[model samples]
Target: MGADHAERVAHRVSGARLVAVSDADAARAGDLAARFPGVRAVTDPLALVADDDVDAVVVASPGAAHEEQVLACLEAGKHVLCEKPLTMDGESSLRVVRAERAAGRPLVQLGFMRRFDPEYARLKAVLDSGRLGRMLLLHNTHRNKSVPDTFRSEMIVRDSLVHEVDVARFLFGEEITEVTVYSPAPTSAAAEGVVDPQVSVFRMQGGAVVTNEVFVTNQVGYEVRCEAVCERGSAMAGRPWADLYTTVAADDGEGLWGGGVPADFLGRFARAYDLELQAWADASRRGEVVGPTTWDGYAATVVCEAGMRSLTTGEPASVTLVDPGPAS
Candidate 1:
């Protein structure tokens, strides 16, 4: 993810330049830095944050390192674009939120790139324009071709399902009140004792319900789809592959017709990621932050924590978020 973001900033995004690269692996950082002219490689991330030439920072490091790096950026008065999870858990995420609040400005933007996807943006527009009346239900599907054996059941909730958690909030503008997760029998493709597919139901504060199917070992490529059902009508958005079917001649005199799916999320949402970074760069230039805020990150973490509990207990769990207080 860090390398991908580096490529975007150096080649695709405007108003930003790749000034430096850092990683625990010094050689890896050096190799990436060598690709961009005048870019330096730093071994320590905190040193990267304290660099004088770096006006703003992008935190694509491991989630465990996010709180310290983000807090360092805030203290240095630099804008930041941090990738998802915000931190490894909800408590650290809230601490980062408090640090941002103490800074007295919105300096951090969470990388919920789906919000910038063209189809999703159009769907959001349709829902908000009153054309759909009041949205009452959302159906989300998240699938992947495969994952490493190291990826566990809880990771499905934390890594894959977390995206849907934010989508529900982003589209409905309401907090999720509760979440219930149901894990069925594992598929042969899944690691032993791992949950390959998970079904999660979310109840929103506004009486709306969301259902999500998360299948990490679907063996059918990366596919994400969302449909919003409303009082008057419904709207759906999905991968462009959904519209690009092809026909092929076969020896049996029958034709095979189907569309191709992306091998990963990068292929599925490349444009969205570019636009997200561009928007972040543009906003940082103005000393402002845009897109998903720190609060969105914290909320998703809180909801995912509840989902993990449900995964264990096989029962619905109520979502809880600590009030950021009147100052927020």
Candidate 2:
């Protein structure tokens, strides 16, 4: 994601310039820098964050590293766009939230790219227009090509389903109040002990119930879909992208329905990424932070932890939150 964002800012996004990049591997950073003349390559992001030349920071580092990095950037007063799961848990994310509040203005924009996706934006507009009447239920389906060897059972919610977590918030304009996970038997396509297909129920503050069904090793394609059921009618999104793509279909039941899905997420949400970065860049240039905030990141972590606990406890869990107040 770090590399992806750097490319977008360098070439695609307007008003954004890629000045420097850092990676754990200095060579990798240098290689990325080689693509753009005058872009500095660094071995440490902390140095980049503190550089006076760097007016803003993009935290595409792994979730564990996010807490300190995001805090450092904010303390240095650099505008930031941090990728989701926001600090791996609620407490760390909350600290960032408080820090942003202490700064007296929003400074961070979370990377919940679905908010910028054309299909999702249209769906949200319909819901907001009351054309869908009152949104009653939202059904979310996330089917991935496969999971990596390092992927674990918990990632089903922490990583994949996390998108839907943020999406539900974006569409309904409300926070999730409760979440429950139902993990069935692991699929053969999944990592040995990992749970492949899981279902989660998320209850929002506005009486909307969302059922998110995630399949990481669907062996089909990369597909994400959502349907909003309302008083007047129901609407859906997530048609396969027009770009070149494929999926897996073995001699089995689930695989039997497999066909063309996006080859990867980038091709699927390319425009969304561009729009999100463009918005962030435009806002940062204006001395403001907009789009998803630190509070939204904090909320996502809270819901994920609750769902993980539910997976073990076999019971519904309530989502808890710190009052975001004005910073949100």
Candidate 3:
């Protein structure tokens, strides 16, 4: 993801430069350094954070490593942009939030890039305009072709579906009060010993209800979509492209075909990535928090952990949140 972000930053912002990159895999780090001229490759991430030439750090490492890396950057007095699902669990997220508070400044920005998407922004605008009236319920679907074999079973909820969890919270503009996880019928595409699909039901603070379906069996393509039903109207957003059909001459007959997934996840979120980076960069320069803050990341992690507990126990789990004062 760090490599992808670097590419996007280079593409969108001509003035941006890749200074240094670090990863556990030495060869991979070397390749990235070679791809971006003048960028140094290192195995220790702390080195990148401590570099005198480095202005800021982008923490795109694994979910488990984010909290430490983010706090380290903050301790080093450098701004940080960390990727989503902020940490493996809420405890670590809280620690990072506290670290930011101790620093007396907003040094950490959570990467909830979907909030910057034009469609989502438009939806928010409509909601704020009172056109949707009182939002009553929300339905979100996040389907993918398959999950990597290396992915742990717990990650299905924490890392994979957490995207919808965060987005749902953002859209409702309220915290989730309670959550219940349901185990539906199994899917053939799902790996053994793994629940290929799951549904999470959330009760928001303002009496709004939300259901998120995270499925790993949409073999044809990858899809991320949402629908909001309010008192006055409804709104939906998803892939905007239409199927392109072409006539083919075959021995049997002429056939038409149309379907393809987004080339890559980064490609699908290209605009959001650029907007999120620019927002964080501009805010950092002005010494303010313009994007998602450490509190947002902590809240999302808390909700995700609750959802996981709900799934494991087959019982409704209530989320406990710490009021982190005003938004950073």
Best by lDDT: 1
Model 3 per-residue lDDT tens digits across residues 1-328? 8888877665665445678889989899999888876889978999889899888888999887887788789889998889986788788888888878888888888898888887777787788789879889899988777666665546777876777877777888888889888888768776676676788899999988999888776575577778889999998867334343344566778664544566445656688888888887777777677778888888988988898888889899999998655434
Worst 10 residues of 3 by lDDT: 239-248
The candidate, 2 or 3, that scores higher on lDDT is: 2
Q: Put down candidate 1 lDDT per residue, 1-328, tens digits, no spaces.
A: 9999999999999889999999989999999999999999999899999999999999998888899999999999999999998988889999998988988888999999999999999999999999879999999999999999999999999989999999999999989999999988889999999977999999999999999999999998999989999999998889444666678777899987776888999998999999999999999999988899999999999999999999999999999899775434
lDDT of 2 by residue, 1-328 (tens): 8889998989998877789999888999999999987899988889999998899988988899999999888889889999987898898888889888988777899999999988898888889999769999999998888778798878888888889999999888899999989988888888887777899999999878999989888886778889999999998878543333345577663554335567568877899999999999999999998788888889999999999999888799999897856643
Mark the regions of model 2 whose C-alpha exceeds 4 Å error after superposition. 240-259, 324-328
RMSD in angstroms, all models? 1.2, 3.7, 2.6
The C-alpha lDDT values of all candidates are 0.93, 0.87, 0.80
TM-scores of the candidates in the order shown: 0.97, 0.92, 0.92
Off by over 4 Å in 3: 239-259, 324-328
Which residue pairs does candidate 1 place in steric collision?
Answer: none
Error of 1 at 250 (Å): 3.5
Cα lDDT, model 2, residue 236: 82
Worst 10 residues of 1 by lDDT: 239-248
